[model samples]
Target chain A: MIENLKEIKKDELLSEVKKYADAKARFVTAVCNDLGDKLEVTYYFNASPGMEMSALRIAVGKDEEVPSLTGIYLTAVLIENEMKETFGLKVKDIAIDFGGHMFLAQDSPVLPMLKEKKEAAGEKGGE
Target chain B: MAPRTIAPFGPQHPVLPEPIQLKITYEDEKVVDVLPAIGYGHRGIEKACELNEYPKNIYLCERICGICSCIHGITYCEVVERLWPVEIPPRAKFLRTIWSEMSRTHSHLLWLGLLADAFGFESMFMQFWRIREKVLDLLEMTAGQRVTQSISVIGGVRRDLNGEQKKKCIEVLKEVRKESEALIGVLANDYTVKARTVGKGVLSKDQAIALGCAGPTLRASGVCEDCRMQKYQAYGDLEFEPIVETAGDSYARAVVRARETLQAIDLQLEALGKLPAGDINVSVKGNPPANEAIFRSEQPRGEVFYYAKGNGTRNLERLRVRTPTYANIPSLLVMLPGCELADVPIIALSIDPCISCTER
Candidate 1:
């Protein structure tokens, strides 16, 4: 159930996630999307005793960096490092920085997920 | 004082069947820090989802974790189902519940065997696996395959359980329960087992929550939270409390899983008895409306989070999975430090590490 999608300014990312942490919400996971010019990052927080997911989405320009949540929830380090490696998103102050080597091995394609690809040659685009 | 040393536990080891290496730094026999090197089993399953059509992605998801393959497919279907807003038939819901429970039973049994082997209990390990074989047989009898039963489709289950199969399932579950109970009793009372596990690799309740551990690992640390309690699928119709132990040690984690196996059996029986007669699947057609959905399920190890975004095409725009073991790995860093070098394998095994799930 994804009705709780809340958009946050990039600068407010850490403070907003901290509010959920203060309210005893469990940090579920973070997802990053490459939107060509900007990156859309969503951090999911789950409230217990019920099945509600609150997501905080932030859009960062290609040259910009987003604050890390490892200071708030230690578990965020792994996923953030993964985002750093996969989506090529820059995260500041990770609790344990694997140095862009969490899920992808060194010497693999850089930002493989965000690499540009041509659309299907002659297929109709999705409606 | 003895000299400090760095010992690599495994990228490959006898106790660990999966590919995960823990670079443990120790001061003599006491562990000072642990660096987990994963990605050995990464197959880019998430990226592969984009390459396949939305429907065919079910098979891809099922391959993410072979041990919990049924639930992986089920959760994937549920995520896609949310986009379409299709109602799975009552019988299909119950069947999903039953099969999910069966997967849980088999997974827990398999983990119990691996943990026993980690402790050098060879005979106990074999006994657990022997019981596990019967569960696999029950799965095969129903779904036509043992491991990686691709039963769940985009809408519902691909097969239905008949009366004869139901009766046989009950019989097999009863035998598994009996054998597992005897083994659990041995693990609980045996002095050597207790001496090895109790008060070892302790993770406090606060630390467990802060680290985002889930399922048995979180429950063992007295969090009393379970994704099952969220009541997705047939869990709402079932009755069971999250098995929690306050000790927050290796022994507590073992006990939580052993008891969860019994809970899974009870859940399967309850769902089977309440199975209703109806269509097993609804006819799902067309692309899901442009939308986003997140589905969470309680896997044997922990909570699995699936996110799907459809752009109204056959292929989903994005499909991301955050598996249980991925969340539980951080807790290993919390637990591993300060444990004795001898207890590293048992403590690591206690998390029921599934690198395939984590890396996928």
Candidate 2:
């Protein structure tokens, strides 16, 4: 269970992740939740001396560019690439870019996991 | 100075059983850098979770990794149970603990064999898998499956362990313990094993924590962090302590997993002795409320994370898993840069990467 989620703006997300990184916190993973209008990104970090978990949440419009945290926490590289491929969100300065071939096949549907409800229905009707 | 050459380590190689391609940039015999290209085994399982009903998703989650199958289902159930808020019986909790450890034992033994094979220790590789078969037999006897034991559901376990089955399990574990002790002795002191592993692919404590290395990999670096210590199931009542090794090298990682195999067996025996009586499962009749839940557990490789978001429907809105191997992959990137080219296979196998688990 995650608690004390402070919603930071997109600009502050990297510094916030770095603050925890300096506290010897292990970067758990980052997740993107599609909230219809705006997407919410939550990065989970676990700190010890006690296995206490704290998360930072940031809401960005679907087209907003979120800065990649791979510079601060090197492990952020994989999850960031995944977020780019699966959700089709624009990420700025990822440490490694697979040029949209990280997980999806080139022949596969574009942004298959990011379809909005009505758009999904329209696509389904078209097919 | 030796000229640099680009060598592709795999998408298929004799040493690797998976489809991850490591494009290695090498200067003569020393590796200068490695760029790993994955996703060859991706099955789009997470997207599939949004299509299936909640209960049936249990079986789908179990297939995420054949090595650590039970934990995937258990973690999924823990997330769903949080949303549905089902209070499972005590008997079911104990059963979950037992089966999870059974999978841990089998997974670790399988890794030990594979690590041996990676370094060209063929006879030792056969010996380790020989012990692994007995552990698999115990899992099959109880859960009726060899690899994917679909005992976990949304509410609780799908089956119960009887008295006779319990006794047989203990006996089989005793034989496993004896066989493993002999193999562990060889792993610990054998000159060839030590020569290949002792100083190779070292991940310091600071680096392991910074890179978020999980499970035995983190523990081997003297981190003292284990998801099991969080005591999610009946582990609170069970006596437990995480095994830690200070060296943080390939041998330390192997030693930590070897010791953990014995640790998992002890915990299983203790849970079996203290087994309680009650229903193995409970019935749930509705969709989860609109909310999100996260569950973490100690899988054999490291910490496994499950995140589920419910939208008041039979199918979940989103299901995300951050497997141990995924967390450990960056550490591989850190370790590979300075090692000799010939040592790459041994170094790669040390983390016990399950690309299927990572790419799923």
Candidate 3:
């Protein structure tokens, strides 16, 4: 029986994770590390109520840096890269060896989620 | 120590099926180091999911891997179906299982053909592909499409196998089995194949576990971790164990896949015999509530992990797919450095590298 964790604010989410980590693999469910705006926080099997899988929304405000979890978890490396690519979040101490070519087009006009619309009747007539 | 020459193996090469370039540092005939260069086929499939609706994304996800298209689609649907909690009908489950096994048969046969071609056994390659055509015809007949069939949906499957189609499938499968048995006999007992493949590109059991290799690659190394054992579909009702080999080499991998192909035929026959009678689908209404579900399924290559996040909408918030080839790449890197340059293709093929799946 898997329980779905609700969305928790950043501060409370961090505190909960720290509390679980202090217990060391006892309370914490499998933490699926995803690098994006939403942190998919999960509780292990038999996690108590109010302690289900919670997605913590990380704020990307200027001068308010996102905390690095690399010191704590090895799987955060790929997560950090995905965050930087998807959410435009700058992560510190996250080294990415791109191996020469840029894989993500961060500034493309056609966002995948947005519906494609024809160009407005015109800045310029058909040449 | 003399300076070693560095040469890139492929972004495109004849021997390599997928576009994976290995920057190999060679000391004459011996490889000192190999750095894998991937992302050649990356289409940002994860990003694409954001744009497409959940139902439409099924097609998008199916194309994630051409060989294991049905499995990919089924896995994606399973994740979404979990969010809604729709109980798929028994007939649908049986149909899904049948198509899945058919896909597996064709995929394994395709792999065998490529493996044969990799070793320069051109005639064997042709014979295997000729047998594989029957499986493809069956897929087209039942699913109405050959490759990347969008047969599965969130609630249940989109199509049902009628009695006539089922009989046709059984006939074709029997013919395929006969042809495949003959081909398997030749490959299993042939002098040249054994001479070329035996004791080549070995990966010890410990190394395989340590590197987190999955599916046939790990099974070939004697690790028995198969997701199908969990029995997501009618696999629970059916009976089978993970096929394994203790040798952990290219030869073992070949033998494992070859043997598994026969097992697939048997599984299909059993599934068809035990085909249930009922409605194909239970309608799933409304958007899925905010939920996260993790689904795992064994594709032709290995165990695939899919994580779906829904926020009570037609469009899913996030869908992440971690394919098996990505996990196997590290193990492949380990195998390449010790083997000769000529043996590289066979060793790489042994892992069944699907760069499209990995890079997507």
> Which one is best on TM-score?
2
Q: What is the per-residue lDDT of model 3 for residues B30-74, given as tens digits with 9 covering 90 to 100?
A: 777777666566687876886678888999999998988999999
Give the per-prediction TM-score of chain B.
Answer: 0.98, 0.98, 0.97
Ranking by TM-score: 2, 1, 3
Q: What share of the true interface contacts does each candidate keep?
A: 0.53, 0.62, 0.05
For B1-360, candidate 1 gives per-residue lDDT tens digits of 777788899999887888999999999789999989887867888888987898799999999989989999999999999987788988898899899999999999998888788778999999999999999999999999999899998778999999999999999898999999999899778898899899988998878877888888888988888778878778888886888999999999999999999989999988888888988998898999888888889999989999998888888888899999999999989898988889898898889988999988
Q: What is the lDDT of residue B116 in candidate 1?
A: 82
Q: Candidate 2 on B75-186: residue-level lDDT in tens?
A: 9999899987889989999999999999999999988998888778899989999999998999899999999989998788998998899999999998999899899888
Off by over 4 Å in 2: A117-127
Error of 2 at B255 (Å): 0.4
Cα distance off (Å), candidate 3, residue B12: 0.9
Give lDDT per model, in order.
0.87, 0.87, 0.72
Interface RMSD of 1: 1.8
Please provide the root mean square deviation of candidate 2 (C-alpha atoms, Å): 2.6
Candidate 2 chain B: 10-residue stretch with minimal lDDT: B13-22
In order of appearance, the predictions have TM-scores of 0.96, 0.96, 0.82
A1-127 in candidate 3: lDDT tens per residue? 2444445554564475555444332121133333343334342311221112333333344224455444443223444444444333445665333412323442332223212322444422111
lDDT of 1 by residue, A64-112 (tens): 8888899999899888888887777888889888877666765455666
